[model samples]
Every structure is written in structure tokens, then in C-alpha cells.
Target: MSKKGDFEAVRKDIAELMHQPEYDDGSAGPVLVRLAWHSAGTFDAETDTGGSNGAGMRYEAEGGDPANAGLQHARVFLEPVKDKHSWITYADLWTLAGVVAIKEMGGPTIAWKGGRTDYVDDSKLPPRGRLPDGAKGADHLRWIFYRMGFNDQEIVALSGAHNLGRCHSDRSGFEGAWVNNPTQFSNQYFRLLLSLQWRKKTLKSGIEQFVNFDEDSETELMMLPTDIALTQDKSFRKYVELYARDKERFFEDFSRVFAKLVELGIQRDADGNITNTDNEKGGYHA
Candidate 1:
């Protein structure tokens, strides 16, 4: 474990990294969140095979996964931090970057605990297709997220993160920001979902998605089919409405779920070595 002041230094390093002139949109904050999500989202309670701790994404098997297309940008973005803070594990650095991004982007300050260790090689990569599919429905969302041990409310809370970024054409084959102020965190995503009149269109990228329709102008904000599912499904819609109505509530829930996520599938042995987490429901989160 790091001494008391170490995490504060890590946070400082991350704040510096967030504002690179060469990075997309001048903020790596959004993609860092995606990187952390993809890293932890692979956990399966039954197998205890994957999560953020391994940093297996450094290896080809996980790095090359199609769902992780642009994450290399986020990963490589942290090289300088790794160089400076050699004592911190890659897993801890990556997830803490996500926490720092949320706060610096004018979102919540997520609670985080550190001490993850990196895996040595590719042997620990989770099987492909464990991450959520963007174009799927609520059922697919449940199946994917449930494997990571999230309940529906937690899923909806985490989904509010879409409020911070856009889908890139090169990465997800989908395009446009989720809100006008994509770099700023807010409840706008849910508000837009409820307020906008979205129209389906097949883009030149050969992807199908919903775009806000305005006969007078171009629509820059979008919602994936999975995003749309929250509204269309009665059960998930409740939390969506709750978040859309109260940004503070959304922030609170988001922080809770995220703190849990960054630490998912993490357990330490008696000698204080990181190990595969106990797979029991709510085990790691506790």
C-alpha cells in the first residue's frame, strides 16, 4: 500500500495529463473513463477471470479487442505518469485516472482506494466479447453488466457517464457527442433522451444510430440503441428519469458505482498480494 500522500501526487500527475494539446478534444478525460470501464467491465462473478487489476489490456489479446479500438490513446497517454510513479501498479493508475477525469471534468470526485498489482504477460486476458455491445438492447445490457456483478440501478448510474463524451466514428463506427457540452459533465444526456425527437439513419460508416432530428439544421448529438433502451424499457427508465431530473443525484450515484467499479474483482491475500477477488455478490465492493 502507498503512503498517505502518494495518491495526492498521483492525482496531480493525472491532472497534468488531462490537458494535452495533442489529444482529441484537448481532454483525455473521457477516453480514460472508457479505458477504466473496459478494463473493469470484463469481470465475471462466476469465473473471476478479469477486471482492472491485471492491466492485461497492455497485451495484444485484450488490447487488440475491437471494442478497445481507441483506448490505446488513453493507455499510452499515461506513460509519463507510470514513469514517474513506478511504485503504483498499472491497474491502480488506470482506474485512478478515471476517477481524476470525472472530477476534473467538473463531475463528481469519486472515492478511490489503491493497491492493485499488474500482471506480467498476456496469459490473464479475459475472453473477447465480454464488454458490452453498443448496438444492443436492454437484455444485452443486463447480460453484459450483470456478469460484472452490477444490478440494474447501478447499470443506469454508470450509464450516466455517457453525459461526458461522444462516440467516435473510427472507434465505435458511431458518431457525435451525447450533449452539446460533451466535455462537461451534466444531466443533459437523460434530459435529451426524454426531450428530443430522434430519427434513425444509416450513416456512411455503415452503422445504424439515432440522431436528434431538426429539419432546419444538422444534429450533432446522438444516442446509441443501448442508450435508447433505458427510455424504452419501463424498469430502466425510472432511474433514467431520476438522473435526468436531478444532476446531483446522478453525480452521487455515479460516484458510488464508479468507486465500486474501479475496485471490482480486487482482493488481497494474507501477505498483502493482489489476487482474483472473491466472486460472491457484493464481495469486492464491500
Candidate 2:
């Protein structure tokens, strides 16, 4: 095991593990990103609960939630890295895995800190249904993200991550990739959202989603109802058009928003020490 506070070493290991031939799209990057997103996405600003401070997903309370289905692949992929670096907490490792995975996958370099604790604060554990629903519309999108303190621009920027991952039918009841190159990270998701004429299609699972056929790739691309809602709402569509037109702007905004997302519910001192984290077990103190 590596020495304590060696996050750089951990980052290298996560990058190496991104290549998984047996996993979806031949990479663990997407799921790793999703794991990190779901981990911190549980934050409720009003209650000062959830967020990445506690690795609650390690238990059934968070892990068994339907919103988190299939993320075990991400945790299992990082297990070897965690074992090799025993000093790193699951909270820090999970979030860092995502930051590394995004950079390794050619996305923007996100700013991340590593003081998160794995100590499960029972009172702070987020309840089920806190995550965004793929089948929902604009109002639901606003309700879900606004609770986490995200604005319309930030909401649209975060959706840009769809460029790297596909929805699994068995897991989310939604299937297909949002972009042609599911492993590469880019503004392709925004480009496709505006360019394609997506039609609502009902799958055998009785789930309805938007689809568009790409003649070049001869493959079908998809958009969640929430994704389509981005264009339907004028407030959200402005950011969509901005991201689609300027790739650099999208990357910049996404980096800031994602960093903000992970840091939710984490109160830090001026020196960057996490004040709200439980310092007893697997926790960091300045």
C-alpha cells in the first residue's frame, strides 16, 4: 500500500484501470464518472445532508437505490486501487476516480480536493429518489438540480457528460449511447442534441426515450426526456446552444460545475480543510 496522502499515485492507478475490455464500451471511465456524480448528487442544500463526505453508497441504503443500479461495476473496478492504497478513503477515491477518468478520457481537467471522509453519518444519509429521473421533463430537472444548488447553465453543462456513456436497458430501463464515440469526451452530446431530429420511441421494456439514427455510424443515438427538455425550455436552451457552439466554453463551465457538485455539503476552512467531515474514521483533519 502506498503512503498516506499520495493521491497522485491513486490517480495513476485509476487511469490505468480505465481500459476494461469486458465492461461497457470497453472502458470503466463512464461508469466511474456516474459513480462520482451519484455519490455527490445526493446533496440537499437545505438540510446540509448527503454529498460526497460520507461514502453511504457502500451500504444498501444508497447502493440499492434504483438510481444507483449498475454502479457496482465502478466500485469493483476501483477496489484494486483502493486495496493498493489502503490509506485512501472510499469517499476520496470514488470522487478522485471520476476526476482522473474524465481527464484520461480527454475531458477537461477538474479541480478536486481529497479530505472527504468514509465515516457514514447516519443522520446525513440521503434518502432514495434524490437522484434525477431520466424519464422526467424540464420541471423535474429544475426541481432535482435546484435542490443541489445548481443553476440552468450548470445543469446543461453537467449533461455534457453524456458524451462518454450509454444507458443500459437492464439498469436504467433506457438503452443506447448519447454520442457516437461513447468513450471520448467532447461537446458531441450538445451538438447531437441540437442537430438530430430525435423521435420518441418506446422500448420493449415500456420505457420511452428519444432516438436519432446516425447514417455515418449506422447506429442509433439516444436522449433522455430530461435531455430533450433542455431544448424545450428557453432558459436551459441558451446554455445548450452555447455549449454546442463553443467546446472550450463547455469544458470550462463543466469543470467548474462538476467541482462545485462534488464539494456540495462540504464546509471547508480557509486553508481548505474540510470542517464538516467526521474525523474519527477514514477522515482527514488539517
CA lDDT of every candidate: 0.83, 0.92
Candidate 2 local lDDT, residue 61: 89
Candidate 1 residue-wise lDDT, 115-218, digit = tens: 66665334445899999888999999999989888999999999989988788899989998877777788888899999898888799977999888544446
Clashes of each: 0, 0
lDDT tens digits, residues 1-286, model 2?
Answer: 8778888899999999999998878999999999999999999999988898888999998999999999999999999998999888898999999999999999999999988888998999999999999999999999999999999899999999999989998899999999989999999999999999999999998999999999999999999999999999999999999999999999999999999988999888898888876687667653
Top lDDT: which candidate number? 2
Instruction: State the displacement of the C-alpha of residue 55, model 2, in Å, after optimal TM-score superposition.
Output: 0.6
Q: Which stretches of candidate 2 lie over 4 Å from their true place?
A: none
The TM-score between candidate 1 and the true structure equals 0.90
Q: Model 1 Cα RMSD, Å? A: 4.5
Each prediction's RMSD over C-alphas, in Å, is 4.5, 0.8
